[model samples]
Target: MTNPERDPESGKLTERYSDEDFLEAVAELEPASTREIAEAVGCSRRNADVRLRKLEEAGEIRKKKVGNSLTWFSVE
Candidate 1:
């Protein structure tokens, strides 16, 4: 399959999924966590959290509690 997004020179994901990229990843994954996305984006979990929250507010992501911590996922 073709990649949804990638850096032109390095040919790696430039950052955490854009809204569209996150949607693509979520479509391919079960509910995932902020840390997971953060690692994939090559950023700090805290930074990912910020972007994730923005996505959530835009109705691109959904957050749910799993045990003491919360995991974020793309919504239908």
Candidate 2:
């Protein structure tokens, strides 16, 4: 997945993150919600959710329902 960032001064597009970035964010903030992960990754919650689901499918992460929200954790 390509996460592009726009330069504030030059208005140029730049790559901001990668799959590893998302993995690191989840590892750092284990048992975190999508919102939290997104905030940490400087992306939108929806974007985080999409990547998170992919990670979960790959068995790199796991998710559990905590009350009304789903919390994600790195798979050790």
Candidate 3:
């Protein structure tokens, strides 16, 4: 599934990320927060969180709560 959006300023199309993108981001930034993953994937925190949860369910990744924040880690 492709998430495509148009840039208001440039009036150009942009490609949103997928679950795989989030997974790669988590691997690259292991032990990162939702915000960090979202920023890296160019998506919203909520979006990243949802996909991250899905990946977690699939055993592709895991998360831990550090104080008030949830940090994600790659299983591989």
Candidate 4:
């Protein structure tokens, strides 16, 4: 199967899996847990944490602390 990402040439995604993977995970998933992103990205939990942290620092992702735990979400 082809990559589920958008083709730069064709300008069409091979499949919605890529976007769905992220969107579905975030849909109504407010106050998201670190584990949620890991499951969404289909990566290691530690790896997910790192990616999320980077995105957050870059302002690509937004995170808020609900008590001791942090709930992450995408800004746009």
Cα lDDT listed for each candidate: 0.68, 0.86, 0.87, 0.65
TM-score of 3: 0.77
**Looking at model 3, which ten-residue stretch has the lowest summed lDDT?**
14-23
Off by over 4 Å in 4: 1-28
lDDT of 1 by residue, 23-59 (tens): 5554555477777776666557887778878888988
Residue 32 CA displacement from its true place in model 3, Å:
0.4
TM-score of 1: 0.63
Colliding pairs, model 3: none
lDDT of 4 at 60: 65
Runs in model 1 with CA error above 4 Å?
Answer: 1-17
Give the poorly placed runs of model 3, Cα more than 4 Å off: 1-15
- RMSD of each candidate relative to the true structure: 5.7, 5.2, 5.8, 5.9
Assess candidate 1 and give its lDDT. Answer: 0.68
For model 2, residues 1-76, the per-residue Cα lDDT tens digits are 3568899999999756687888888888887998999998888988889988998999989999998877999886
Q: Write the per-residue lDDT of candidate 4 for residues 1-76, one digit (tens) a residue.
A: 1155778999887642344454455554756887876676676677667666776687766888888777887686
Model 1 collision count: 0
Error of 2 at 17 (Å): 2.6
